[model samples]
Target chain A: EADIYQTPRYLVIGTGKKITLECSQTMGHDKMYWYQQDPGMELHLIHYSYGVNSTEKGDLSSESTVSRIRTEHFPLTLESARPSHTSQYLCASSDSWMLSVPQYFGPGTRLLVL
Target chain B: AQKVTQAQTEISVVEKEDVTLDCVYETRDTTYYLFWYKQPPSGELVFLIRRNSFDEQNEISGRYSWNFQKSTSSFNFTITASQVVDSAVYFCALSGTGNQFYFGTGTSLTVIP
Candidate 1:
């Protein structure tokens, strides 16, 4: 199994609340990504980080922000969450050998904003 | 920009039957990567296969096989004599030099016993 993990497997919160989804990997991977996906739908890249302190927004412009303070930790924060932010968030990590290396994904965090 | 398209939204096949999933991609990069991932009921994405653009050779692993055709810009997956355990949502993805990965909407396959 992959050594990646996501906190708060399920969350239900009222609107306008700040929330953060946690992602941690023990594989020491340099690349980490945050993807937003609706149930049974495609995954949209929301944020990605190449390494520690390196972060970039993905193709799908998202209201959330991500930080890579430690190599094993990449957390995404959403200030004043709204119903539009209700979706499953998947976390994945990969090593430098990306050509042949497949990304390992976490269990994913399911969020429901009221 | 790299994009992957899984035209089939859902497919149903009886157990012990064969099923094929189609994946079409668009990219200008000479070298890139294609991948297939399975998301089961557990909601965990499992890496199924990865094929680089340079490698056009088709691959077969047990009941799962991948056909990569550069001429048509298509990479199709075939599952022969599939079982109920094969039911899941399969996604086709593309990644280029920048470590940016893009995924398709995915095809949901159901294997009925």
Candidate 2:
């Protein structure tokens, strides 16, 4: 089993609220990513980080921001959340040295903005 | 450009029946990677298999099998005697540019008993 974990598997908040989604992995991976997905839809990459203090936006634009201060922790924060931001957020990590390996995914956090 | 396509949006099959999921991909790189992942209702993506461009040999694990055809640009998955436990959305992905991954929309499979 993968050691990746995401906190608050489900979340519901009012619009304009600032929230943070936590992601941690014990595999000591150097690459971490965040993806947004709707029910039964494809996953859209929103953010990723190569290592500590390195972050990049993904193919899909997102209002959320991510910070990688530690190898095990990559947290995403949404300022002034809106109902449009409501979706499932998935966290994944992979070994930097192995490009052919599959990414380990977390259980994912389903966010509902009221 | 790298892209993965899963043409079937959904499929329903009776228990003990066989099912196949189609996946077609496009990439500019000669050496790329193909992958399959299963996402249950729980929402976690479980890695299934990974195949490289150089190896076109088909693979089989238990009742699950994969067919890779470079000429057709297809990597199809087949499950024999599928069970209800196999019901889930399966996604096909392609990775050619380093760690960048391109994923298909996914094909939802429902195995009814």
Q: lDDT score, residue B17, model 2?
A: 99
Least lDDT summed over 10 consecutive residues: which range in candidate 2 chain B?
B94-103
Task: For residue B71, give model 2's deviation from the true position in Å.
Answer: 0.5
- Tens-digit per-residue lDDT, A50-75, candidate 1: 99999999878999999999999999
**Number of the predicted model whose DockQ against the real structure is largest:** 2
RMSD of candidates 1 onward, in order: 1.2, 0.7
Query: For model 1, what is the C-alpha lDDT against the true structure?
Result: 0.93
The top-ranked prediction according to TM-score is: 2
Query: Against the unseen true structure, what C-alpha lDDT does each candidate score?
Result: 0.93, 0.94
Q: Please report the TM-score between candidate 2 and the true structure.
A: 0.99
lDDT of 2 by residue, B3-109 (tens): 89999999999999999999999998988889999999999999999999999999999999999999999999999999999999999999887678889999999
